[model samples]
Target: MRKLIVTEFISVDGIAEVERLPGVTWNDEMQRFKEDELADSGAMLLGRTTYEIFAGSWPKETGDFADRFNALPKYVASTSLKALDWKPAELLKAHCRKRSGN
Candidate 1:
């Protein structure tokens, strides 16, 4: 079975807010995990908020995360982000494959 590992950027207080440099704690772990987690995935999933942030920053930066992030098939769950320029990123308006399951 595959997995839909939901990752988010949070503060030490469990506040789900975006931080610039301080939130780099899980960078290495996330990069390593995503590198392999996305390999067997048929698609990627991101909420509108997360998608916008991710779309605007990642794949544009230079690093290992960029390589891994840009490589996977991407899907954004959004009603607003109608136009995505990422080579393989797509906006999902309905249900998508659930990590090889329903």
Candidate 2:
């Protein structure tokens, strides 16, 4: 079985809203860590907002990281989105329980 690893950035006060956090910046070490993580990941599973954000940005970026991101299969879990424009992307069914046999 494949491992499902979830990574996130949160503040010391347990705030997970990365965009709203102040004084947040990216550095070479962080970039390297992200690059390595992406390289090792087989596919990406994203929510609606994150999928939209990444789809809008990564397509325009050019580099190993962007290339890897664009090339990997993307599975989006969204209830409102009817379709996906990003290549190799699929919109998961709203009822995951059926698929999971839960």
Q: Which candidate should be chosen as best, given lDDT against the real structure?
A: 2
lDDT of 2 by residue, 27-76 (tens): 99988899889878999999888898778777999987788889999999
Error of model 1, residue 62, in angstroms: 2.5
In terms of TM-score, the best-performing candidate is 2
Candidate 1: pairs in clash: none
lDDT per model, in order?
A: 0.69, 0.83
TM-score of each: 0.65, 0.81
Per-residue lDDT of candidate 1, residues 1-102 (tens digit): 667776566667777756564546666777667677666566677777777777778867887656766777777776556687765877786554445554
Candidate 1 TM-score versus the reference: 0.65
> Which pairs of residues have clashing backbones in candidate 2?
none
* Candidate 1 local Cα displacement, residue 95, angstroms: 4.7
lDDT score, candidate 1: 0.69
* Residue 27 alpha-carbon offset, candidate 2, angstroms: 1.3
